[model samples]
Target chain A: MTAVLDRAAPAPTPLRRDRRRWVWGLAAVGLVGWALVASGLFSGPVLNPAGSGQFGRFAAAALRPELDPGFLRVLADSALVTVAYAVLGAGLAVVGGALGALAVARTTWGRRRTGWLVARGVVAVPRGLHEAVWGLLLVNVLGLDPWVGVLAIAIPFAAVTATVFAGILDEVPRAAYTALLAAGAGRTTAALYGLLPLATGRLLSYAFYRLECAVRSAVVLGLIGAGGLGYQLALSFASLRWEQVWTTVYALAALCLLADLGGRTVRHRVAEPRPGAGRDRVLSGAVLAVVALTAWAGWYLALSPATLWSVRAREQLDYVLSAAWPPSTEGPLLREVLGAAVDTVLMSVLAIAFATAGAVALAGVAACPHRAGPARRAVGGVVRAVLLLLRAVPPPVWALVLLFVMLPGILPGALALGVYTLGVLGRLVGEAVEEADRRPRETLLAAGATSAGAWLYGTAPALVGPVLALAAYRWEVAVRDAVLVGLLGAGGIGVVLSAATSSFDWPAVTTVLTAIVALSLCIDLLADRARAALR
Target chain B: MAVGERVAVVGASGAGKSTLLGVLDGTVPPTAGHVEVHGTDPAGLRGRALRRLRARTGTVRQHLDLPGPLRVVHNVNAGRLGSWSAARAAWSLLAPQGTAEVRAALDRVGLADRVHERTDRLSGGQRQRVAVARLLVQRPELVLADEPASALDPALADVVLELLGSLAVAGGGALVAALHDPALALRHCDRVVGLEHGRVVLDAPAASLGVTALEGFYGVSR
Candidate 1:
């Protein structure tokens, strides 16, 4: 019976055979789409050689870790700001997610499926959208209040958290719920007694996951003038202070890693159920204390509810509303916007393809830590660390850094996105390789086949399907990041969007926002279909 | 064969017992034959017709093809996939369909409580039982077993074979299984058709065929 499950399930043979052909066909279409856009990508020389001196300085600065005392103090302070934003942002996401989850609960609307779908969809709107875009949008209405930074992070985080919370709620045992119902208990009492206890642990762990994401997003918010290490980094980047930029980057990296380590620790502790009541109590206390401190810091920023309704804020919002009404479709500007969007799509496609290809080589070593000598394993470790740094620094930061070496254009954006995407794709491909069946590999090894040859014959076939699916998923993400990559330094529709937003060109900004949302949805749908097909 | 007839097709490797079963299951068209199954020509069925015919005739292959990732209940429920509307079937995955009916089917195979458990986590014999449970849920007029117990231990294999036999007889349906071992054919089956090189070499009641008399069916035709 192993043969039936090994190669095929009960799915008919024709469907099985046709699916393989369909995958290849989709891949070909993707390539042709990329080619069409790529062919029209260039007009003039893509890069200027004038920045070679700055590039050299930047290369030299990488050899020296940032250690100046005054600069170190600034980094430390900014680091605190970034963490506070993340903590407060995550706290806000939790509150918002809880409220949103209530709206999404099926029992709330009863048989009104459309209401549930609408609630779920409204929650999903912020997901996959760039936090920088949120920052820009909020800043337009709210000015530079601390709420802009917090809300930008909170909105999307809440949207995703709500969906996950609902999933956890759905999985909670219904026995207590049924019992409560039989006793004529209200939905509120039953949910509180039955669902909350079951869901809190998983939701807390997931909130920790969101915290790590929030930290990264807050850093991205810096590009749109929301204060943090990202703001400082962008400043240092603008003045060609390579060493200072690297120092700020190192601090940001430290903050991200710390958040990740702490989140993992908390999640691990939360997951341990047996013989850990005292420890769980202590951990929960610590979490609450930290949250209180973060809320205090967030409050200390002097943002008041009164400021939200301030005459100036209201006037600015009114001005923006009047200005942005009715998106512009001027013939010349419309063509230019479309061209830039096409460029953005092409760059993202190129980025994913390059990242997937390079990641394969990186994954080969990473998947097998016992690959030959200790020297080779050490090299693999070093490579893995570098890739971690690449992804952890975030794409916009990479774009800013790469701006010195290459001209501001689609090419630089593609390179930046590709480098960042490599880290993600490498991890995915490595996991796929590790999970694949090893019997054929063993047989080949026993027959004196070379390790690489054994992998080629055995592991490659299994890796191909999953890797393709993951690469497509990553491409969707890359496209989202590509928007901000241009806004940061490299040129894309983000540059146009940024300019439009700055001059309060509401119509043009609306046009750009619409284009991005449309593109994002289209790519998301296409990738979803492809991933489903692969499954 | 009559509606309640029980038959066994015995063969060595490369014999066409599986091919014949496939043709009877409406999955494979015969090169040239009457190909009669359940008062209809299975080879001539198409689309909805083919699916409807196959729904009343459950076939278990050597590989015991229950989806490993799904719960035992879902695998069991998949037996009625042919009868379910696409939306109903899809929605059933979110929450199980006909839970009581599925549990009843599982009870017959001695795995009524493992319905919610992932099929992959089960032992090999248990997975085979889950597959049998699927056939039980199907309620097919004909039970076709294609070396279904080839992968099981001897004791477990006997349990599976006996369950298939008893279930078919209890449900008043015919049972036809392809067997590799002639001894198993003699023990569990009432009548045997010994196939060699895609043709029947011997046909008789199990009570009449002795151990020595099964040698011709076991010999390699190649």
Candidate 2:
């Protein structure tokens, strides 16, 4: 084709996809095909109808959870430990994030694009790994120390927090900052006087959001024996005590709800502070509460700095490093890693596609719109709770449970991650719905259009952009979370890594981890490109 | 320009008025000509020296580049950022310092009651007055204002210009403001410098110029 369109040629149809989008669309279709083939769905029977009886028992146990007073007390204690881990982990992440943001921020690098890129690259290594992976590695060194749970969450979350904080800081209008610099403020002081205030609301809101995620990550870490609710769940799950597993799951769900509610309250207050101020009282109270909770969490965990430098810790570290060095480049190991990496990508793509579809379907009912009828409100509340429960029960738990009825395959694993992600994507999509401008819909309705017609013309059009963007963003997260689900022999690099670790093949473990990080980085870049294209 | 003399720089859009102010404030370096602010070339200076020079040269940009989410008091206190220690500057955001002075400055701008309000919540004219209040707290020896009263009505604009003029006179400093209105320029300033296409078209004592003549430099015919 010519670089310039012929003057005589008619314009292309508006509905037609541009070349870039067509290319992306084709690539997407190709990837889906690859995922399906790799899933081996057509090659074999992937059903285990007999296991449904067992799955049924697990489902029924959700209704009559193990409510023995003794078990309840144990759950209560474990729940506190989970809370402590979440609080301390999230709190430390925020602090580390602040420092990391400064290190990586464009404002800090200014014209030094290379330095900024380098900092971002360094951060991606930690950010690419899941909390569970960190927990696994830390377990090798720390061996059941409370620090493992905290650090696992803190490391990856801090990297994420840094990325987000830097974005927030970067997005602040630079006029105020430049004006401060013109007025002779030092770089740090200028940023403080200018950038910080503008970014504070978003930063605080994100911190609260991270706390919510930390609560979930803490539970996930517990699954790998970090000692919390997930540990109890795992213990019961191993013994096939479905009732006790459901009880632990419910307890975990309640903790998640509390964290989500508290975080949402703070985020709202921060977003719209009360008029006048010595400082916002609600915000001050929340900050004070977090500080108190963090202190208590630290004390309760009995975290000692000495543990990090202890002889045994250093020995384990040295041993692991020596064993893991010169990561296995053997032909068989490399080939397996390559295959598993593709499987991980396919699993994530399927999971996100499933989640996006489900989220879009449920988002309308999930969003609690003002002026909605009582019946609508009740459905919305129930949908919201179900979404919460879906997300709260860690992905590994979902993976194991799904394995029972779906047979050992990628489909079950993808569905498990898909189900959990839907919980998150659904709420986000619902919020997008709630925040959408209602004027168009109302006007359409006022014009005597049917409700479905109004929704189609007004709501759906606006929602497509935000929902797609959220789904694309979550695609990156699903890939990382896929590692968690994959650990349970669900057909991903996680499975390979788990085997290597179990066999004490440290070199092979390193190779698998490298593959996971590489896959994640590729997905990260692809997701970014997709977002820009979509935008 | 003599100390305490209020000068108004007038020009069409993109006529280098802001560029000139930028050079004087040391934020923009002149490619050809030398610029000496308070007897030091800001471009030649470095580190502490440059900051000290800038601390004494307060600028009120046309956009009134105050952080919108910040409290009015903190925006006003940002003027003190040049001279205050970083620690003090950071602390002042949480628990404002020198509120008495800030209040007095706000009182002059008729925004005393809005000291605790967010800067963005104010109207355009009010935010402009807040910028003036910032300069008041800064107490710089040299004031540079770019269309500082553009958002205000005639009465408030006069009040704002008068405050700026008096501020310069009180501190034995010079006020060099870029004004869009010739009448205000004549009333508030001693010297008026007019430019077109980055070249100075007219430089005369305010007494030597008339509104109609200044209007010509603005390319206006009525």
Q: What are the chain B TM-scores of all models?
A: 0.91, 0.97
Pull out the clashing pairs in model 1.
A1-B63
How would you encode candidate 2's per-residue C-alpha lDDT over A439-514 as one tens digit per residue?
A: 5444333222335544554466556656777888999999988888887668888999899988989999889888
Docking class of 2: incorrect
In model 2 chain A, the worst 10-residue window by lDDT is A1-10
Best by DockQ: 1
Could you report the Cα RMSD, in angstroms, for every candidate shown? 15.7, 21.3
The alpha-carbon lDDT assigned to residue A127 of candidate 1 equals 73
Q: lDDT, candidate 2, residue A260?
A: 89
| CA lDDT scores, all candidates in order | 0.76, 0.84
DockQ per model, Cα: 0.02, 0.01
Model 2 TM:
0.68
